[model samples]
Target chain A: MNKQLLWLPFAAFIILGLILYSGIGKDPTKLDSRLIGKAIPAFSKSLLLSDQTITEKDIKGPALINVFASWCPACYSEHPYLMELSAKEKVVIYGLNYKDDKQDALKFIDRLGNPYNMIIFDNNGRLGIDLGVYGAPETFVVDKSNTIVYRHVGEVNERVWTNIILPKMLGTEGQ
Target chain B: MKKLLVTFFILLVILPQTAFSVISVYQFDDPAKEARFNQLVNELRCPKCQNNNLADSNSELSIDLKDIIYEKVQAGESDEQILVYLKDRYGDFISYNPPVKPSTWLLWYGPFVFLLIGGFFLYRFQSSHRQDTQDQQNDEQQANSMLEQWAKEAKDQETK
Candidate 1:
């Protein structure tokens, strides 16, 4: 029993080492959203460059709420994929013009080719806070009931569309 | 002239401490509210920066969060309400103080369990060490009594 007990410390060290080692290559920046499986927060903001008031009711489901800003470089990187998703894939994408001015946002859309069905202007980023947005190029997949199923931070690429987003989009469509 | 320049540089460093050129400065008429605001910002972590709290983080998200906190405090919302609001948006990761839950039970109790194990080992070692010393002392006592008995017998023999 004493001999067996002597191995306990070594066993503990090994267990701890294994646990820490598993976390080595894992990205700490990727955080799961607390808002997942919950309905999108209600807000009455204006559409981008328009006087029309937009709300949670206005947002169509089986769609994406993409938070983007003109100043964010990652948004520029993910622009082509969003265009393809919108034009070819026929996926409904709503733009959230986060903390960007009307003129710059218009120019940005013009340059990138507008991929959004309709853009919601979040001048003060109040709506972005309501949606729990921390950075630009974040996308949330909304189900038919307007429940947010998944949220992806950073840029959305072809791999993300194929693996992460499409399944959620199709899953939400029948619901 | 060198002494004057040194004093000027010293004044330059000291003067900025009195006047902050920060963006998140909110004008609060109530000192209590201001204190609560300051406390909340320090306690709340910046979701973008990950490491820095809302008070110190210069990230855009941190600035926006600070603005929301200021509004919430100004609107006479309680600290708990403000915490709930932020927690709803950012999850428990926003607060430094994690809630007591099953998921975190290991985090809270693991150290105490290890401490108990260490304490048990130390106590066992102490008791065993005492036993060793006790046996040695008993042996010494037995030898001393034997020597005393021999000395008494020798004296008795001489006397007789």
Candidate 2:
């Protein structure tokens, strides 16, 4: 009986170890609502469209702040979605050219046909890092208060628009 | 051979501390001192394995801190005293097992408490299994004794 009691903890420990091991490689869901309900980070860059300096104040009213780069394949995937959003014109959209060569970003804008009111080039990516952006094609929906209400981390699609954006614009989903 | 075995065990305990940058529990000879070392390690976070318990981590910082803990224990400081010193320097984030303050009680006790409850169920299951086997053995023994009595009666009847 004493021996069984002694072994119990060890056996229990092994069972716990198996449970923990099964959980390896599974990423815990993260709530990245840090920038949410906070003022948008200040941004200013040379425009990829008109080759003129553009500042965040230029599109201050109500806008979608889309982070994209020429080198990112996901940006290309999101191109059509951006064009569709532009066609709606219900909400103005601005693109922040994150960590790209100026010439390539300009060329990308030309090929995609600019859907943005104006594009801001963040070549060194300082502003992008400040916005907590890790990769390209991230979009944030900002209110008139300058507080970011929504953040999408991956490629934008019709599903994202119909589900997340339209409901947000209609004020049925989030602030 | 016994002498060699003793030496081998000693080396096995001491070699890892000398070889890699892992904090170990062998530095303190006194139980009180060893407890202090454990307390210090538990508080310090392993920077490389961000989410792991420092007591379980073999990271470089953990090793260095373990050495320091060993030294402090030898110097006769209590576990609480050493922890106070570390907290002064590194703040609360240094400890993987943060204290159950208003801010961190949920974080500290949540997972471990769940694990303990799970362990309790496992213990009950193992004990119940052992009890069932013992009961089966008892039943078999009683059946064998009844069969022996029947055999004896038959023999007696034949003799009569």
Which candidate has the highest TM-score of all?
A: 1
For B84-158, candidate 2 gives per-residue lDDT tens digits of: 755543446556556778868657786998798789878987998999999999999999999999999999999
Model 2 lDDT per residue over A118-154, tens place: 7887776656655656456788887776667777878
Q: Return the lDDT, model 2, position B43.
A: 62
The residue-level lDDT of candidate 2 at A5 comes to 74
Question: Against the true structure, what is each candidate's TM-score?
Answer: 0.85, 0.51
lDDT of 1 by residue, A89-111 (tens): 99999999999988999999988
State the displacement of the C-alpha of residue A34, model 1, in Å, after optimal TM-score superposition.
2.2
Model 2 Cα displacement at B68 (Å)? 31
Worst 10-residue lDDT window for candidate 1 chain A reads: A1-10
Flag clash pairs in model 2: B43-B95
Pairs that clash in candidate 1: none
